[model samples]
Target: MQLCAPVGCPYFRGMASVVVEFSAQEPERLARWWADVLGWHLDTRSGTVVQPTGPGVPLRFVVSARAKARKNGVHLDLRSESHDDQNTIVERLFNAGARFADIDQSSDVPWVVMADVEGNELCVLEPRKVYADTGPVAAVVIDTSDPRSDARTMATATGMELAGERSEFASLRPPSGEGPFLEFLESESGPEGMLRVLVE
Candidate 1:
């Protein structure tokens, strides 16, 4: 398929531009839950929103009556500045209604797997310098059969710069002075797991 780079494409990669979108059958409820958790702005009657912080990205919630088809192949990997911070945040998330999700993950992993109220999964990771200066929403990642091919489509469609590329993986991020990245990876095995994202 021919990829599209929208009109005014250059500016669409701005930090304040739409960075991510979530779909929900009960949009108001799910959106509100996350908004509160993230300290984002919430308007239950409309799309979920989060005011940009510094060069952070903006997020939105869209209405969708359809049930999730399967576990998401894309998910959020949240960053932490320290192990203590990671533990505290995980504890807070548990108190706020997030629960550990056993996605065939081992207990020794550096990241904790947890599911939102609606069963969407997310990870809270130990501090890594790459994300040390990024926002609470660090990166959006997905699995693909071919990172190079997928990166091309993503780059053409969103105007995000091709930040990095290698044999097994590729990443796209908003241009300099913009926001976080959107990554694509070619798994040793094909994708089949717990991660989902709504991009439309």
Candidate 2:
């Protein structure tokens, strides 16, 4: 596979996109929850699929017998307009069957951790300018042992541009710079997160 440059990686001019597939015991129910959360349309005519109205990734929910046993290393981060908006969103989700989750995060963190009805972890983050154009979902974060290397590899594989990098974090996005960012976070543990990822 072709590797990206350390910095200033080349863009693929929107030739690629990513689809996150979730495995759940009740696919339609889980898909409905995410569809409501994202203001997307849920189509269960065949298999469960959540389709976005505008720019965003399409999520697919597949039936699985396996249960979620631990924290998800790959999770989504929702964008908020402000502090009040963040709280409102969290409350709305709580009423919709979402529950607060603790993944060893400190109390002072700017984001609120939550899990869906099926124990799938996600975050509602404080407002930030960088995620202003990313629609409802800000980013799909993957916990990796080496953020830099994994981000670079994923960027190359997905034909996305390397957006930015720090000591313990890295980011990638489509060449058009629209939609949610794909982030890699440095973690000490091994891969024990969500199921499948489809690049198209």
Candidate 3:
């Protein structure tokens, strides 16, 4: 389906889009809550939640029937440019009702995990230098119904080319090699999705 642009949206243009589909029994309620939390809008008519970051940066949420089983295999990892900045953002998120995840980072790792209002776990990491100098921090495994189909849609929407595909999985690398490699895996359990992003 062709996406219609929202009038006067600040970020209505971009070359990258990230779409995460979550399975919720009460799709409307969940979507509404997330829309408010993320400062996005909801198209209740279509039952799709979307946040347009820019012309190309589209963050979408799709609802399904699967119950949230366990911690997400793929979690969004956000990073800040500096410690002070990270702390500030973390505090803000916490105050805004985000729950903390028990991820110890005293060992020199760059990131920490936290849970969203719905108990969906996400990570907040340090600067890219930590990963660049220290190597990969973690791998995200995306659980989906049809990984190949989802991967293809993402590839088409984000202008990212599919590097490879396995029996029931597909891999996508962001435009910049700096971002994490996103792998899509087929799951019968339901739509438990994850994503990673650079905060600042």
Candidate 4:
């Protein structure tokens, strides 16, 4: 997702986690899908149906008529405790309306790529030590035209520490150096829109 243009919002620019709102033909349906998958409650009281997940931004889905053109540049990477857990979760996701995503990855790929009810891409990763402490979500990755600049902007805005930076990629973690990370990688014309943001 693109960096938010925070101006006259109610909360301070850096004080709040960036809310990830998706444009969906059926906001309610999409919201329900995520809520079911994440086991979180959906809040539709304030217009958008939201499912807040920990310190990260609340996942919100807004009603839109326009359909998405391609796979998103930003997607969720869900971690598993073991191979069995991964298979279980993948089965649950498909049962709940998720479908296999043909991302050109062969059967040897370690992660399970799937699309949400509205075709938003997400990966169920096999358990690894790196994500042992990051909780269920491993990280939020964004493909950017300029990786370093976008990473710097996000680090400054969120007070996240820069873990690494390069022309092709950059990574950031919270000030305390815990939880999920926000990563940026160089690419041509990344998908544009704000869907979900990793906030702490």
Query: What's the ranking of the predictions by TM-score, best on top?
Result: 2, 4, 1, 3
lDDT of 4 by residue, 1-200 (tens): 34554422122234535555678888888888887787766887776555434433356677776787776778778878999999999999999999999867799989999988888888999888766755566777787898889888877777767888887999876664446667787878574643545333
> RMSD of model 4, in Å?
3.8
lDDT of 1 by residue, 1-200 (tens): 12222211122444223345566777678777777666656643434655454445555566666766666667777778899999998998899899998878887999999988777778898887766545676677777789888887777765567878998889877766344567787865444443333333
Evaluate model 1: give its lDDT: 0.66
Error of 3 at 137 (Å): 16
Q: Stretches of candidate 1 above 4 Å error?
A: 1-18, 43-46, 187-200
Which tens-of-lDDT digit does each residue in 1-200 have in candidate 2?
A: 12322211122233554777788988888999999988988877657778767657778798887888888777889999999999999999999999999998999999999999999989999999998877898988888789899888787777778889999999988877777898888988644655455565
Which 10 consecutive residues of model 3 have the lowest summed lDDT?
Answer: 130-139
Off by over 4 Å in 2: 1-14
Question: Against the unseen true structure, what C-alpha lDDT does each candidate score?
Answer: 0.66, 0.80, 0.54, 0.71
| Better-scoring candidate (TM-score), 1 or 2 | 2
Answer with 3 or 4, whichever has the higher TM-score.
4
Model with the higher lDDT, candidate 2 or 3: 2
Q: By how many angstroms RMSD does model 3 differ from the true structure? A: 7.9
Better of 1 and 4 by TM-score: 4
